[model samples]
Target: MNSPDSQWSFTAPLSAVPEAVNACLDQYFADSSKEFGSIGSEFGQAISYLKDFILLGGKRVRPMFAWAGIRAGLEGGGGSLSVPFPDATPNPKALLSAISALEFIQACALVHDDIIDKSDTRRGNPTTHRKFEEEHRQKGWLGSPEHYGISQAILTGDLALAWADDMLLDSGLGHKALHKLRAPWRAMRTEVIAGQILDVTLENTGSESVDDSLKVIEYKTASYTVARPLHIGAAMVGADPQVVDMLRRIGHDIGLVFQLRDDQLGVFGDPVVTGKPSGDDLRTGKRTALINLALHKGTESQVKKLRDALGVVHEEPEINDLRELIIATGAEETVEDYIRIHSQRAIDTLTAAGLSDAITSELVALTTKLNDRKF
Candidate 1:
């Protein structure tokens, strides 16, 4: 085991990748704006909203994962960064394009996610629908301002997603690499839509068992967040079966940890850190870890309270009370412990795969940073 500063340390050095990716995002949106028309201000505004989402600071974990997979495949046998490419040729430009594609795809997903969840903000900024809604009201838009905002934002997100696919296809990856990437990329998109439907269904109908909700979380949050990205990236570089299998297992462990951390943050992170109101999850009555815990472990009376809180999304003292109750019931601690364990497990899995220290170090660092995220 390598004694290191922390899991997040390696990530600090990787920040430049995200900045470059953001520059690409800016260009992408600018092109979209110009395509719509010089004077299509509404379209321009929507494109700007997409740019804001792309520029919003995040861990950039998915893009980094994609790059790492490409690197691993290019190096062959999945080892340290010290390992040179087979031909001793580094394709930095191609790698950067692929990474940007991953980030843009994530942006598209998040935009759609906010609309589905009716979230008001993201990364400390107004969500697309929320921004459009406010703009509509301020400008005294024609009939049904709220509906118009939602409709336009949804369409904008769809366009972003379509563009993401185009970026990936046009990323200049070789034919073999592109073919490898095709299946998982296509599957991920299809599954995400299916997952979204399941999510909406659960929110409306409610789950009788925690396991059911967990299934939804796995699909809606996990596969896209970790599994598919890993597979796609690995495929891009023509990873062999052994390496692909290892990446899948690692991706599952890391992805679940990522979602678990998000659940915890939804309940406990600072408003400034999370870019949402305190107890926002509770207000939205999101079926998160906290609610799942209450449903599973609370007394009957507490269960009733949790049910009542579902989908409220309003300002109320009871929302805060529910947050406290969730913590008091030990759900928060349970989730925290779960995150710590799986995060370490991910690192251990990577280490045992006999990867070089440099690669293992970076992978461990990525897992740690995500697990420890404040936002």
Candidate 2:
């Protein structure tokens, strides 16, 4: 059932979601730091790094999509042509806090992903594991700094997941809504891990087929990043099953394009802009669709170049040669085309989801921003 106060006193402008969600995260961090302060100075310091890793900066894509889905679900619940800010919801802050949990899940994903990928930096800051490793070195701690770093980062990721569940429960969404959210919430966490496992397995299997790459993104990125967040909101508001399904469908395609854009940036983007070295994906031997297509479409020599350099090349010149091969093989062009087409298809589905034009336009804008991102 919808909340007693059907309309919030104020509606959040679309521009306010990131800021609002950030505020929630800031508050949570403050409370958490205090609650966990008694553990130990070393533990306290570790928490600080985890806090900074999360709050330093982010695009807040997951929370924004969660809020967007809430908006859609609110409309669906009311059968209204337009949504009032959080109509049929609990307290504005409460509901916002509930959705803001997505950020914590995101935090968990990023920290663990860095560990798995052996990434040095994220958004121009040291990755969590790297930060911990450096701390161990600086303090002359009594263990392998690399091993210490990974262990701490793993715990940090686990803490973030714990905090996510707590945040949702404490957000005052009420038991009924929380109960409804259980499936989506659980599914999101598991799917992301499953996807990560697939990603790791792919690196070893050396399968660069486009289908294989797509399969990895299907669970690892699309579902966790977009679809499940949307599903969470829809379920919370008890939207029609059809609307929920439509959202899931749109989220999948949109999520694909989102990651596709990320793959492009991983190779072609400037280090300063993208916050990672160019060709990082190639260095890591990620079996991205871009790599798969290049392997499939390239001439024998061009294919051999990618296969040889992938997971091995480090020098800029070698990376540049690989970049050229990707472009020369037309794989980059194909990925660009996929991003455009899938983004449009997702938008088209959103347009038909019986939402008000304003809501639809905002979601479309979000999709455009995601695809058009340079970083």
Candidate 3:
């Protein structure tokens, strides 16, 4: 097992990972576009929209973390760098293609999430369904615009998911590497789906506590966003079992930290910055940990203010009121403390895992950037 390396710190450049991932995604999208165009121009037009949606904006968090996982696996695999340092790692382009699948997974999750949330905008633009709805209206289509939008968006998300599988299988990593990746990939898909179901169930039934909220993210965000991606990377190279186990724990902690930050962003982040309307969570009646905390601790009137607005208020002023109530109850600060505690736990665990300075530094750096989401 690796031991803590004090020299490690996050110094990796951000540009390289996203750029590589984007280039690979472009190829995959082009390949897909060609296939769709061969079928029909209507199909071609829709795919073009999907392509723009994907390439528009994103942090590419999952693929970067997956890369970190790959590094971790490489260090422990056997070669001076890993078990299959030179061989199992495969060509650099192939590795990027494989991990880039995570971005598609993210796209599918978001497209579906927006549908479920009935969100009007994403990344400050109309959501998939809304975009399709506008196109339907523009072209004077024959059916209900709303239904057409929903159906098309669903298909778009499905295409993204199908292509995610294709990208991984076609990545040229060879049978052994692909076989290793399958387990985590399967698990991540299930966990995210289960998490989404749990989130919807809890919201409709009323999630009232921090534990309930945590349970939601544990499956919904943690595994899909962090833990399993790490597993996929480690598994990609057949990383040592002990190293894999350590990363799972670290990923879980980090995933929670990431989701907690998301909770804040959901309620407080600027639409310009977050790319979605502030208080979308509130409008959707989604009870995140921060909201749950406020519900438990806020004054009667403040609590009432939140309750009255839950799932009803769509415009301003009221949303602002709800935001203030959360702050006034001190839940925002309390959640920040929770974030500090969880983030520290993740870092400490990673430090104690004692992986190579290279892997340790990159993971720490990624975690830091994830945690420090001021916007």
Candidate 4:
């Protein structure tokens, strides 16, 4: 268990992540460009778009979690766990390559998610599908701009997904470590797809049950976003089964808190901070926990207003009215309480894991950051 006075330092600074991941990404694109450039300039253009989309700003949360997991595994191997500023592991490059694969997976998801949500912007920039759509319009393309955009975006996501596997396979981990990666990697991919299907189905059916929403969270966000990344990292080091189980459990709770925060931000966070329009989730008719709670508790008129506002274009005043209705029902507060509960649950799990103090401190800090983040 971590003591009260334990000290922790992040082995790699968050600022270093972009540089490290971009190096690998740039190499992959350069190699890909050489091979695909012979095919056509269109392939080059698509690659460029993927490059830009990936290099654009993100929190790099998945990679950070993986890094912490690596450190945790290292610490569990009978060392003090506190090391110097750099070179925290035997093969920093291998770890970076393995973890950075998460970014490509994330890019694939966001690209497809933007298409599904009809989101115009991500990280304060035009989304991948929207970018292609605008390009098609500007070029006066022969096909429907929307169709062109969706088609190209789907292909781009496929490309990213393929490249993610390539990156992981080529990450220079031993044959055994790579073999260990297969289960979690496969599970992560399948679970996120299943979750996405569930989410879309729920939206179409207008189901707003809390149970359904939580199911989405568990399969969609929790497993892919946090649990698998931690598991993969722990696998990279061949950590003990008990340790891996503890990390997965901790990740489950933390992932829920992360998604809960994201749901709150969708309704209430600033566009500048969250990089999406206000009330975007409401507009998209996402069957989130907050929405389920509102539907369950809201008055008849309030429910009617919410139902009407969903899945439709709404003016600012109408959106604000919906927001007020959600808040008035105390759904926002209810979700907030869940966030607190999950956050503490995660901390408690960490405390009981008997991990090194330094690793525990870093995980604790991550939990706090995720819990309190506005974005």
Candidate 5:
């Protein structure tokens, strides 16, 4: 067994992920450009937008989780944990392609999400729709610029969704491996779409129940973001059924913690780091666990204040008051405690799986990095 310290020694810097994934994306685009012609050609603008949006910035967490799942699955087959180098496995290229597909799926989600949220920026750059809106205004296009932007953004997101499937099909996995991947792949897509619908419903209906909020988290963020990716990787390797189930459970816990942290950051994080104004969630009236707790525990006036602030962008001082109200109600601490509990639960699940040292160590490092992230 590798010691924890030694196991963690292999944890690659997060920065390395974008470099690796970007190379894959560049090749994907190069081949696509060959078939589709230049950026000015038919459907080329959407392709270029997706390329830039995906390659520009993201934590690349889903792909990393998928890769880790592959390692974990291989370990289950009694393989050696110390491989000495990356992509040294039997089916390295296929695995990388499959993993890279996750980013395209994520791109689809984010583009559609930005449209829904009416967000202007992502990763410190203009969102796809917003960028198109600006283009319409600059070009003096005929239709309403806002409508034109929405239409183009929708098409771009659809292109990403379609390409995600294409990438996976073209990943060079055997027929059997591809067959195995279908279940998780289809389920991931379904869950995210259902989750998005529920989220929009809750926002419109003004539901305050923690249970409802958690349901949204489970489908929208947790399953799509973590559990499904892990399962897909395990499927890619034909891992033991029991091992796959274990990863599903572990991924669910970690994914929930991941979203909770995002909710916190959405409200309290620095704009410079988070790449959005503080209290964006509050402004959007997203029915997060934190908000639920605040509503449940806050005084009547505080509840009123919160209700008033929800879905309406407020000035800094009002935003500060809302922040203070949430903090004063002790919701922040309670949510933090919940995060701690879930984080430990996930670690405990991972430890109980008795995975090889390398897999466990990487997962532990990922959990720590995710839980402690400021953005």
Candidate 6:
């Protein structure tokens, strides 16, 4: 029963999701400041920074996914924007709370990831840690600026995580429903952190075999980014156990394709479109899908050149050469083939599981859009 209006509207949901997310975010800030008002002069400012980061401009895919999951659980009973899922009788306040929790968790992961990658900026702005360090410099703080920034970010991420846990517990979901929601969040945090660790360990270290790199993709990129978000959405609304399991399977296939597409974008996407430097991944020697493919299939001489060019941690023409090698080796086409295969798998899984017509159609369209995304 997958339909275009319902499933494809994942994009349309964003128009409303941020507003919902903000309603919850506002509540969180107000509560935190009230509780910790007397702690320090900087507490208010610190909390503001946290809020700002959550509101950072980018796709609020996670929160939307959560909302969709909740709605899907309700199973299509609602009649209007204000009360979309009439059958589920979902509490508006509870829905906002649950979505906001996912947003905070995402913020935590991004804050830490930016620091680990030494990324100066994110979402077209200075990272939280970097922004904090600049403030310290202006204030003439005594310690390492980057270190101070990282420390503050770590604490900020911790606070967001704690807030997420509290929000989930307070979501007004029944005890059993709350438990179901919490499980995925816990697993996602663990996997993302482990992935971050692996990502950091590889920096300036060396390239890993395809199998090892794929494992990192499974943990670091695919599962938490897409699969878990979809699961969280489903779990929130009390989707059936079997349906939830099926969602996990479908989500994983599409999620990996999503990341593989992203890896391609890192090198080939337009800077204006991607909102980042061109060939950024190559500059960082990121062991992306393209690189892994080239490694597995490139000629011996090509491999030698790649080893020299990759992970060099600098800007150079060599990156262009590396990009060419990726193309020359037909890795790009191979990667595209993989996208097609995985995306079809997602469609097959959803159809086989007999999702609602609206959801099934929407998921397929969304998968197609994701797999074909340029930015």
Off by over 4 Å in 2: 1-10, 76-89
Question: How many steric overlaps are in each model, in order?
Answer: 1, 0, 8, 0, 0, 12
The C-alpha RMSD in Å for every predicted model, in order, reads 5.5, 4.0, 5.3, 5.6, 5.1, 5.2
Candidate 1, residues 1-375, lDDT tens digits: the string is 111112222123344556655665566565666776676776677777777777766667777777666544545554322222234343455545666777666777787788877777787888888888888899897888778778888888887787887777665555666666788888877777787888788777866467766677677667777777777777776677687777778887888888888887777778876777877777777787557876788777877877787666466577667777787677888888878888888788888876556666777888898889888
Tell me the tens digit of each residue's lDDT in model 5 across 1-375: 222122222234333445566667677877887877844653777788888999889988888888777778787533232221224444465667677888988999999999998989899899999988998899997989998889999999998898889988987666767777799999999999999999999988989998899999999989998899888878877777888898899899889999999989988999888988888888777879899989998999888888888778568888878899999988899889978888899899898888888778778888878888999
Q: Candidate 6, 113: how far from true, in Å?
A: 1.3
Error of 6 at 173 (Å): 2.0
lDDT of each: 0.71, 0.82, 0.80, 0.81, 0.82, 0.74
> Candidate 5 regions off by >4 Å?
1-16, 38-42, 77-89
Error of 5 at 19 (Å): 2.7
| Sliding window of 10 residues with minimal summed lDDT for model 6 | 1-10
lDDT of 4 by residue, 1-375 (tens): 221112223366444555666666666677778877888888878899999998777777888777767777777732222221123344566667778888888899999998998888888889988889999999997979999999999999999999899888887666667767689889988899899999889888978799999999999999888898888777777777888888899899999999999999988888877878888887777779889889988889888878877868557787888888899988999999999998999899888888878778878988998999989
Span of 10 residues, lowest total lDDT, candidate 3: 1-10
Query: Candidate order by lDDT, highest to lowest?
Result: 2, 5, 4, 3, 6, 1
Q: For this target, which candidate reaches the highest lDDT against the unseen true structure?
A: 2
Error of 2 at 149 (Å): 1.1
* Candidates 3 and 6 compared by lDDT, better number: 3
Top candidate by TM-score: 2
Candidate 3 per-residue lDDT, tens place, 1-375, comes to 111122222233333677767777887887777766678877776677677778887888888778777777766533122322345643556667788888888888899988998888877778899988998999998989999999989998998888889888888677777777788999999899899998888878876978999998899988888899888877877788888888888888899989999999989988777867677788876789989999999989888888888889988888888888899999999988977887888888887876777677767877887888855
Error of 3 at 5 (Å): 32
TM-score against truth, every candidate: 0.87, 0.92, 0.91, 0.90, 0.91, 0.87
What is the C-alpha local distance difference test score of candidate 5?
A: 0.82
User: What clash count does candidate 1 reach?
Assistant: 1
